[model samples]
Target: GAALAERVAAAGGVIGRDDLAAPTAEWAEPVRQDGIWVTPAPTRGPALLAALAGERVLVGGPTGEGTSVVAAADGEGNAVVMVHSNSHPQFGSGLVAEPYDLVLSNRAGRGFHPDPGHPDGPAPGRRPPTTLHAWALDTRGTGRPDLFGATPGGEQQVPWNAQVLGDLMTTGPDDLGAILTRPRWSLQDGARVPVEASASAVRPAHVLLRVTGTGLTAAADPRIGAVALGV
Candidate 1:
């Protein structure tokens, strides 16, 4: 899949095709149980497909699942982390060579093959099936943290990190940046659903919230600009 369309054009999102355009075998076939070839994700143009074919329609494409996350909480509480390498260029069947192979470039993300009876398939050394989810909610655990978050959009990052932690746990802690700048929803894999023009009606997925205190206020998803920093 051209490394999932160059990791969704290097994470700036939007994969309307033409990464160099060359695959024309009906969108690269050959899945014969597991011969692996896969490719068929590209759309959302042509005037939104002529206004979604004026009726009955279903669409899907744009799945790169790349990642990069950071969550920390100190002063003796504990919670520091780093997560990288995900559904990006994931050098699996891609080429890699020349002077001992220099690093950087999908850095080693996608790799796993052993499907025996499919149960997340692949075995023998199993490790493929990672959406790289991050979460935090020690509300009752006593750690005091209530709603932490993470997102990069791959499998829509766990329903957009559980719908922004259920709207910051039912909109508490005073606005918390207006419940992460409001308007959000996501659920895809069928029946098509997309909403985020500052989301007011339709709904599906997109998130990045933080509800701690003292010095970590955050909110991201300004229809993609995603920004919010308060120190």
Candidate 2:
């Protein structure tokens, strides 16, 4: 389909009148990793949740850098929604119309395949898997609903957020700045990006971290510079 679109759009190519139909967007069930919910949105919510579960991090930490959610139902039924994204801008270029002045070019349909047997196999107008994550929590006393999201390409966003959660829950960083200033993610992909630390701290052997609050806690990989700030 991509090939067709590119060729048809080539110089003086004979593309049928109906060939250029309006594109459509669709939604599907979110993927779950380690009990955390993840949607394919170019972010890392599920991975973060999983890491937090592993670490057993609690909410109400002195300094944690993640967005979480909480919900409660009283005798009278009611519903609420609260969401937040890290709001970090991607910095690069390639695609046209740099509306955000950043390179989301890596998000182009590369992992997708044409074979039905493959996990990322292509289907007619089907949406590709995204890295974005949406999480929620619910309890009786208080209702806190939060959404932690970002746009780090690949899975870079997960580890960054997870480490911050660890610092907040386990290491007990004094403030948000201290947690962030600590030596952060070291990319697994050495060929692409070298792993580096901002401060002198032992890096985890595994490239994953998790955080948990009173209602729900989650972890993510920070290798992609993913962060989870409060809404």
Candidate 3:
């Protein structure tokens, strides 16, 4: 967490954990708006995007190797999407428990601001601003998830996921395959918007699943050789 970095900064760039202990975490609720739910403020991608969209401003944005996303739907019209990440490569935080090797999330380390007073700043047990997020939508007023999806692209996660959700809402589920497999662009570093190579972008994969009157439809990005299969 930032405490280690803070201590090091206070010590004028020394490396040691003399008295600091590993960070801790607890359960929290998701943030919901309209019919969509997000991963909450500390994971500020959704909100940040909203701010940008509100002003219609231009700006940008990780590697997705340490992250993965999955979506599922059942017979009861229930659907879910999950985006999991280690915050960084190699199990993150590197704070594995002695026996079980339970790894703690490094969201505070990579997601937190350095300033003490910033909303996303580091504090003991404070959840930092993470880019990891997804969108869940229930368009039918069923109070249950009717459509869910997410993508893995680290800093690009927000734009990627947001674009897919936008397309989903606008075009519905029939075009899932084309929507994800189409050439995509990401605003990198808030300076340049670069489009991925057609049929060659390697960091590829996204899942969109929607429940319709007939059944559940799922689409998988094919740029990285992803395929739709029954399980």
Candidate 4:
């Protein structure tokens, strides 16, 4: 709210607390390509869209890095696309629920800056950065739809989703299970995880492989114990 107040005061706009309290959600028309329809969840959608649109580019596969999925289907002549993610890493490790097999991790409590001028700085109930996302796509005039989601820390998800989508479209994989299983990720600092089949794949320098996909395919980071399945 302080950000809004600062902006309003700077622009001489008549904004008040009531205006901020009554904010409403907005839904724009779905984005489509060919017979495919896509929609992204809030926040992370724009970045994912940019990656898919070529405004941004990524040159690897999605593994321990973060990622989102887009599903497409047709219906009588309409297409649809959807994207979503938490956009942050798991900050809490103890909050687990077995009934639904859910882990109640704190997502929106990251990316905080200690600067008092920032909006997320030292707030009483501020949410942290989230890393979980859901992305979907549907084709025009069709009933079937494809959905994708992932849990990797921020920024990483964008490229992760793009790579998976490319695999689905260009290579025609039956499911993302295989791709996800053997996925690899590179950090912003140029350190890659789950080392690929290169000399650098072996480790002691970086994180070691936690889970292995199929032969020379993919693997999860052992640190996280994430799993992938193929049929």
Candidate 5:
């Protein structure tokens, strides 16, 4: 973990806390926002059984906003997009960084304890996994992007982006500002937080977009410090 931290720092990434101690409990619990409290318990048994019996079960929960994403486009139907993050900012190996390559820290757990049965379960000296991603929609066979965007929140990345995509397709194809500024939501396994323009929900991450044939115009969520430039 220490060697990985040195490499990440050399590559211009930020390293936060590091915990080398043993885990306190057998299973990790879901972390909620302030004023919320719940017990840490093993994943329910029937839920697993039902899933094995071909029943769909929703899993996962909210996570820290340790990822960053960027996109760029030029005339002539060319575009490029990138999404990145440090996984859990405050837990797991407690290393908040965006290294050029992948991570090699014990903090890969991202606060979720190892479940021997799960695929993403924690193991020794494994690269911390992440859901960080970038998206660009293609119109038929055309390579140009009809819409492209990225978000930083861990588990909220997909859910939040889904909302943005739905709205962009339905209401605000050209209104990028209006689309991103609208209320956003984050949900995992039925736990929901109607994220609004506040510190926790709005501060850490936001959408950045570039639309083709929009006359060199670009927009970024004001809630974040990202900027858009024209070449």
Candidate 6:
């Protein structure tokens, strides 16, 4: 693959060096809100979910966004959910970042509010608020989380996760597949403080969900890729 990638690069192809190296980065601190762990600002996911959970938080306006969400769990009650995104409207910034060759997100310019007074205001070295976020739930009163998942529906990420989680907790895990397969709704702009009117807009935002029961049980939107791959 390395030789092929070198040949491709030499031939003016887009494929660069295949980097199988371990991903390394300075750990960003996490914040807790209403007992849920959130990827802190300038990603607005935590604030959005908190607002939905009836917290007084400030989450600036929405903007175009894109992302990929992945989650996995083990029998020992360990789980992880990850979400990655570019700014919006396809390849963000149109600039390939180093190492990963990622299309750097134009988050600061596009997602952050222009006004400096805003909580989500952008500045040098500051990331803009993003809709990319993962959510988890522990309904069994155990110290570990039994249910968790994420999605890439722009502002719809939180709403979908919240709705599904509510059902999963209320109706029990037996109906989980049915709850996920059922048509879901997304709030308008993913309102910072959702109201009755915000529920006006509704649609099936194709999202993959990973649930850990006896082992790992994955439920994905039928309108999308294979569930086994969690695409």
lDDT (C-alpha, whole model) for all candidates: 0.42, 0.38, 0.63, 0.41, 0.52, 0.56
Return whichever of 4 and 5 wins on lDDT.
Answer: 5
Give the per-residue lDDT digits (tens) of candidate 3, residues 21-46.
Answer: 55446676766766677777556445
Better of 1 and 2 by lDDT: 1
RMSD of 2: 10.9
Q: Of the pair 4 and 6, which is ahead by lDDT?
A: 6
Determine the C-alpha RMSD for candidate 6 after optimal superposition of all C-alphas.
7.2
Worst 10 residues of 6 by lDDT: 195-204
Residue 104 of model 5 has an lDDT of: 53
Better of 1 and 6 by TM-score: 6
TM-score of each: 0.27, 0.44, 0.71, 0.44, 0.58, 0.66
Candidate 6 ranges with C-alpha deviation above 4 Å: 1-36, 55-65, 74-77, 97-101, 189-213, 223-226, 229-231
Better-scoring candidate (TM-score), 4 or 6? 6
lDDT of 6 by residue, 1-231 (tens): 455455446646554554323334577765655444566665655665676576655333344545666666666646677776665665765655445554545554677777888766755556566666666555566644556666666666666667766676568765456776765554554344333234433233333333445555666555344153422
Lowest-scoring 10 consecutive residues by lDDT in candidate 2?
57-66
Q: Per-residue lDDT for 46 in model 4?
A: 49
Rank order (by lDDT, best first) = 3, 6, 5, 1, 4, 2
Candidate 1 Cα misplacement greater than 4 A, ranges = 1-68, 76-86, 92-103, 106-148, 169-186, 189-231
lDDT of 4 by residue, 1-231 (tens): 555444445555555566567656667554545433334433454456666777744322222332333333333333232333332232232333434545433233344545657754545545433333434443122444433333343445555555655655665444345555456553454554543532322211111111112221222233244443232
**Pairs of colliding residues, candidate 3:** 60-190
